[model samples]
Target: MLQRGVRAMRVLRASSVGLTRPAASRSLAPNAARFSSSRSRFPAPLVASPLLQRAGLFAAAAASTSAACAFCSSSNVAMSPVAEAAVAEKAAGQQPTVVLYQYEPCPYCCKVKAVLDYLNIPYEVVEVNPLTKKETQAFTSYRKVPVCRIDDEVVVDSSAIISRLRELVVAPTTASNEDEAALAEEEQWRQWVDQKLIILTPPNIYRSVPEALQAFDYCLTEGKFTPMERRLSKYAGAVVMYLIAKRSKKKYGIEDERQSLYSALDSWVAAVGDDRAFLGGAEPNMADLSVFGVLRAMHGLDTYEDMMRETAIEPWFSRMTAKVGSSSRTASN
Candidate 1:
């Protein structure tokens, strides 16, 4: 079991270089809600299988490694929610103990952090050990990282967490058609962030051995592995991710990862347009934040630098960084 686990981690950790199957292309729904309730749950949880199962393990490790490799430093951002979420728990004389179980550099994990930071919700971070996953063992079935434990209830999936937190902090309001239309747009772009933009990251990051090693180095620096584990994972994970990246391009029909990324950014910029400061006009909406969060996760890598150089996303990104303020992390382990 131990040997199998180690082998799986080596093979799977590099899968984080954005190896998840691409979301099928779909047109926007006219009546898309402010946030879709259809959560991004992994197909199966870890404990359900006798074996540490390839698919679930791939998701867990991929999420962990992808998150840890990119934008490890941007965790601390200034809080800038125009309509601040109330500290409701404080009114009851008890604050919610929010603990984020994550893989430091994963874009999904980064998405969650972006929301938390934007809302100025202070929370603790628990870096899940990618191999043993003992940090999340209590969940039994749901073993993926970026799991959020708010007070007693546990929330898995990045979108679900973001939606739940918004619900808890900001009261729902009746909307005008204009408001609804705005929300529909936000929802569409948010979905695109998960399905389209994120799929391009791994292949681009692990385009070659050197790039793969650089990614693993970031992972090693940010993850909670021991000395021996670090040495093994860094070398083995990089090589595996490099191989996986090649297969990912073929599987996704991405002829060129960087070009695809640039095209995606261009599409986003076009949507924002010359008239509006953001997709939401004067303010950054959920969609804007979601896109920013995913892109921010790729920070510090060559892919990130290249994207910034090659795309028109920098201005909007700069605005987001200013609006999304400082780190809301109250603690970590």
Candidate 2:
């Protein structure tokens, strides 16, 4: 079990560096809510068949050799059947759980969930109103939301969670012969969303009544600040965010960034288009999942609703939701 887990991890790492399957052509749903209710109550039991064991061993050996060759390092592959069993055990008999340490109104957390829904991955959500929950404080010392636990693995940040999910859940479709050539292209787009689109966005856009109330509630629970102090802190955070967005816009040229973002969105929409109903050719694929994750944030804000509605993006969003179905939709507070 340990050897197999290590092998899986190695394969995942390689894929992260552009080593695995080709870019698949498919469209996926737009939210994790699609899968939230369908996950098995327990982790699927590991098959103990001898044939499976042999296959696992072969896979581990091949992955280790590939890693060694790629990095020109001596093969130092290690396996731990015990550790693998532990992880499997941890997931066993539990609800299909996905515990998220997230504050209310966090766009990033919402983005992560959107991908999960699109992939129809079931998860248990734990809302961490940081100001009030001591457990939340303990879970993430840094007080970041969207910190997710899949069984024994603690996934910090949206990208990491997305990557982890892709590994554990098998996609419904396969990549075509031209997938390799497209992997880099898709990766480049994903990086742009993370570094430029998300990092450069203003936060005030999400300061709805629910979000403000949640912040106030959190402050009251933490008891570290008075109501006024909490308000001031949130306001200050917004100011800082605005300044950061302003600087980014100025440096990158707001028009240029906007154009780039729009172009990316347009390209993504076209890629999925009306033809097959998903970004990947027939079924949802990694590209569709990743794109949906980021786009969810872009579309969620009320400020962007009109912009989205006025553009080609709206239809694309509609098509994605239709394919994934309404079960994935979350109640907006």
Q: Which numbered prediction scores highest in TM-score against the true structure? A: 1
Cα displacement (Å) at residue 13, model 1:
14
lDDT (10s digit) by residue, model 1, range 1-333 = 234334555665546534210112221121122222222222122233333343344334443322223211111112223112333443332335678888665777888887777666668888776545667777744545567786665666565566556644433367778878877887788768766887687788889998888877754665566777666656755765566567557867999888999999999999999999889777677788778888887788899899999999999999889877667786667
For model 2, residues 1-333, the per-residue Cα lDDT tens digits are 235435444544454422100112222333322222111112222232122233232232222211101110111112224334544543333233456555434456655666656665555555543323344445433233456677665555454555445444433344455764455555555555555555434432423444323323333333244565555435433332333334345545555444555565676676656777665455554545545555554544543564475457777666665655433322221
How does each model score on TM-score?
Answer: 0.74, 0.56
Candidate 1 achieves a global lDDT of 0.63
Off by over 4 Å in 1: 1-95
lDDT of 2: 0.43
